[model samples]
Target: MSWIVDRIRPREAPSFSRPLALLVAGALFLENLDGTVLQTAAPAVAQEFEVAPEGVSPAIVGYLLAVAVAIPVAGWVAERFGTRRTFLVSVAGFTAASVACALAPNLLWLCAFRIVQGVAGAMMIPVGRIAVLRSVRPTDLLAAMAYLTWPSLIAPVIAPFLGGVITDVLGWRWIFVLNVPIGMALAVGGALLVPRAEHRIRTPLDRWGYLLTAGTVVCLTGGVELLRDGRPWLVATLLLLSVTLAAAAAHGMTRREHPLFVPEVLRIRTFRAGNLSGSVYRLVITGAPFLFVLLFQAGFGWSAAAAGAMVTAVFAGNLGIKPLTTPIIRLLGFRRTLVWSIVAGGASLLAFAGVHASTPVPAIAVLLVFSGAVRSIGFSAYNTVMFADVPRDLLPAANGLSATLQQVGTALGVAAAAAAAGLGTGIAGPEAVELGYRLAFVPLAGLLVIPLVGALRLPAAAGGHATARR
Candidate 1:
């Protein structure tokens, strides 16, 4: 998330180099892929667990929520513990956790292992980036940073298709089992190649900030999950409490001596605009994939293999658009690029309603691919605008805040989509889950409106600083 992007500043050039950088990037790729691959396998996993496909979402949402909770502390933990130790431990823990996930006997067990995976992931990414920041020279910083950045772009494209293949050809379990080798390789490579720096003078732990922020995420995610449980009063209470806790957390952060995210970062006009818009953007785009996979397998009755294979069209879009992202943003400028991208994304989601059981395969592929390209462009622009205007001293905290909010928004998006589908299923009666899938897109597409309007409000020359450098 923002943690990965935020850490790659132009550091003092190190003789330490890109091998170490690539190794760290490899670790991140595995981490990012782990989060996304689950979407393609959710319907299949649901069958294995004897639950609704939407029911599998708690495991997905739980993992992301755990990552979101753990991310704010990663820098502190890495600094206190040393990046090498933390990174090594994280890779080991994540690999072990993936094994447990593959071996899980029930949904609860699976969700628990995923939470562990998320924690390890939270450690792996920031620590890895911290390692690169310390070791890479200023001259090599761009290449090193680009290596780390690729995972965010590459993983989402291939995860579903790859997850589908692994699930269909091997089993759903192997999709998780696949992480072991990658993690092992990264761990070994990291041990041998990564530089070991002495611990810094560590910052005091922000105990109050940690508790408030973690509590806010937990209660909000719990509230969202409870919405589908058919308990009206409980849902209302949890949601109300989540909002209350969020306000309290905001207050706690502002008053703290050393806040997790400095209060002033939010006051930066460009950062504020980017964060708010990015949240809504991620919520819709990230959640739609979860719903789409479910719709393909559970609703339209496609085989897991078929659904996975076909969904590669979206992956294709993500891949094809990457090289063009910077160029497009530079030429169009941030505001225009973002506004048009959001429009394209919103249109694509709206068009998904036309994808029927009888729709041609090629047509579906084209739609997903085009949508994917549009979404990618918007994401790239938002990430660029995020830190573009922050003063150098505040960049780190601003990046951390951006990363935290990114995960939270993504997790919430997935939850919202699933919960919407669940509620629609209930309203439409049994054997009508497909209708729920279609209805869920209404809100998913609607979320783009927030980012669209936000992007429009930005100055025409927003992100000029970042774009000029690119």
Candidate 2:
């Protein structure tokens, strides 16, 4: 791992070197771009494939599920192979998968391609992050992370607008096609700028462990899908399977010499608490946007363009609030920031239940903007605090575990929203849709209570070094 650190680090700070910053920034941009660009194109893709809009959602499910399955092994792969090789391979695979997705003839084929794309996409963020952490000094780490965060936060904000424009002008295929040039540029930049690591560890691949973890994630995600589809019996069975797989995976990890995730990290109260809270927090945060799209379009009779445009409020608020996040954390501290964020986020979501066609556009926009800002503050702080208590030695494993859970939370959030929207059979058209959105937010808002409690476990100050050693 230290060898990875040495190789992935830049020789000097990149402030003086334009090419280096651009290369890293470009990689980060592509990572965020792929994460969000598909959402705006979903409806168009559904039309092209001649399926229900809900059917196109599987494309998202497949991608996230693939990411969840692949992320755990990413650090291990980097340790065994080297960061440069793994990164290059991941980019190539992602680019090829994007091409395949653009050319896919049917929904099934597109979903398959998306799964491949997801697996490839999963590698970019973590591997790039590892490279960034290794390349920069500790003092510069926050700034480097901020550089990467800019794209991830901004992409989702502008993605809807960009995707809508592309779909309207160039057709939905262009959405995936756009990645071709971006991916190519990033791959070239990475090859040139990122250093190759010499210290390679010969870690044994945990095949059984991998299967168990993968099975658990798949079954859990699939179970959520089934529940949303209203298959009560199947949902129950799948849930049971998911639980069994998770238990087996946990057992396997404990017994193995080199588990996929080190058990010791879980022993740290802050790490464990932070991860649990963050997962629930992410479920609500990620899921809410997807629900908002459906609500605005299907429920309120808004056009795709108009609905997509309104989403810009989130981006605006996110950007506006970022500068204040750290200061707010310093003032209120992490625990207060996290708890209040969850409370504010849940209240904002519940407020959406009152939105109607008669509601003023500006008022609705303000609410969305507020929600986005509060959420950004909460989530960024949660992610930051999780790593605070982690020792340097456990960073890789913790990162892998946290990344996987982040994807899982995202998938689960979307799934939960889907299930909630699926309720109410009698009402049709916009009324039914509005009811679904309303019902969905109720439970989602309630789930925020979990994280509100979880935040209490975070230390008042960073003085729990002894606690972390447990």
Candidate 3:
């Protein structure tokens, strides 16, 4: 065991070329944090605005729809405008939206501002990724991805707690108010850190491709949101529409000379594993926090803060395991690291299914920490390898596609968790609420099989270049 650690240990510290990756990670944190924070603030916002809590759903759903609709065209926007300029504008726009949200006089006004925020957020992440991919050397790709991965890991876990604190002490509007300074700081950092691309691609925008792809995203995400509201007919119609558009979009990509995405990029086996199968991994991973938070509160009769505190254990694990993640990947290679992480992550979920009110707090925390750690490793590996073999020319399209799929995966995760939890409750009966929540983990763990199978099939040398194993 000691030899194993020693072997994976870095001989010297890893270094990044600039703070650009960190800036991008900050942007990702803000985007993720804003979405989750609103979940906590909904009731308060509704009260202040004199509406039903569900009335606030429009603001949330509107933002998500805007993000989904805009994501498919992010690459084109970056190319047409330029990466640095687009990123700066995105940050500025998001900040201004935040201000508008803070000052919104009514639900309608808040929804409008949130839509603006969504459009900016849609542009912020993928463009930042484009900047990073274009500038970072292949040797530093893993480290750069590591920087970008933490925000996604940490932000969602902490937001519920942080949002509750802010809403309780200061009020819900402060949630948006706080983004002003962070946004300003990120804009400054991006300007100083992110390099201008030496060249830009000026290909004509694939208008048809954009419409089909964007339609697919909107219908898929909006349908899922509609499901939670119990609008079965609307959800069904949107699901069918989404499927039709997706099939058309696939055909367009392969048939068109210049499609929104180059179909050939999927032929790169590593990228395929990360982009396609990795989404399955993300869906299960993203859903866990949602389940755990609800389980601790509704199932165990714990307070909201207490439930949130348990998630903080997972957050702690994400950061605690970060320094070792790259070394582990370097030592074992992406395939082995990913395989082990998936298996370990599944085992952690199974462990979660066994936890009950009588279980020791320390035991639950340790299990959560382990879950968070393996998830971190798996995510970094997937993100790095997704672009491992993509040609420099295809980076923009590849980044846009990956970003779009990732967003869809994230939206589906919470929905999946909700659906699974509902099924578990039905099976267990209302009298066994705790068991119902515990049962939710069973299916989520089972979903891991999809990615595990994908990992098992990966070539031993997958993502080798990122780790300098070539």
Candidate 4:
């Protein structure tokens, strides 16, 4: 009877493999599409609401905060509900939230809707990833992950352009409205295609741990906002509060029988080093685009469409490097590729500080493209290496922790860049805008050094197949 039950389980029986890839890829594309599609629309939204651009920024911040708060809870939700149910719910929720965002009337309403959208979106990619991992064979895993990675990496490159076109032609609201069909399609496909998995052991939800973690993330993110707003005292106070909350949460979680984040996962040396390195690496890489937008629009006095178009160079570079990534990793191995890519990426960013109005557009485009390509190589290598040592049983916990940390790093990077740009403008006046951008790159370059040190701790053959313990 037990054997029959095992044989009858609804494991993803391999069928229509190509369609399976498309379904997963489509889900990933929509997930990334929403992530970046709003950036270019920010200015338009501000104008519509008759508020300052800075005031409108809360839409972005609020979304990010929601994602950060929701990520850790995903593992528990997935465990309680089966993967199929979770994916369907996540996609459906995101679709509904997207409609709410499209119809929002005022800035306040829009911000509120965006938070809902964030909550819904927070589950899409991670749960989708879990589904893919469970469904695909190990040999096919790399290809599946690569397929997902392309959309995510490419979204930023095309987002500004897409957002600008939509806003300029149809209106800013369409950016959110556009997600309606895409989201609906993904939800239906996920329901139909994703296999149901049996819940082997049900772990009780760590409600207290969830609250403490949520509080810590909110406080820390708020502190970053305070610092950007130039409220030094408030920043300090909030930072202290965040520290206290985080410590308290850590203490409490350690005592729990089923902690939200497993302490044992952190004990793995490679996972720890990979996560730490990846977080810092993302700070500079992720934040650089926000700074560049300001540099092009506010400093160089480029129109939104033109500024958005400039990023195509970066996108082109990203695409050009994709075919080469696996081969390069296979050749140089993981550690070497990651290290050199970081150094190369930092240098490219640092070089951007020298760009000026007198600089030819083509020259600038080349530099941007090169930077994008190098970054793609580095990030993929780092992300892949992080999971190499992670055991199968602990994947859920590791994914949650890594995802949360990455979001935190992204928020910090954006805030830090904004604060630095503000300071640069204050001291130099209008002329200082370019210099502010330049100065911002310096520290971002310095951030790469931290990860480089961490990379040193990884084995020389870290990225090779032999290094995978599973």
TM-score of each: 0.86, 0.89, 0.93, 0.91
Minimal lDDT window, size 10, model 1: 135-144
How many clashing residue pairs, candidate 1? 5
lDDT of 4 at 367: 93
lDDT assessment of candidate 3: 0.86
| Candidate 3 residue lDDT tens string, 124-234 | 989988777775667878877888899878887898788878888899999999999999999999888877655777888889999998888888877866665667899
Better of 1 and 3 by TM-score: 3
What lDDT score is found at residue 392 in candidate 3? Answer: 80
As a whole number from 0 to 100, the lDDT of residue 457 in candidate 2 is 62
Candidate 1 matches the true fold with a TM-score of: 0.86
lDDT preference between candidates 2 and 4, better one: 4
Q: In candidate 4, how many Å is residue 99 off?
A: 0.9
Stretches of candidate 3 off by over 4 Å are 1-16, 226-236
| Candidate order by decreasing TM-score | 3, 4, 2, 1
Q: Tell me how far the alpha carbon of residue 222 in candidate 3 is from the true structure, in angstroms, after superposition.
A: 3.0
The prediction achieving the highest TM-score against the true structure is 3
- lDDT (0 to 1) per candidate: 0.78, 0.77, 0.86, 0.77
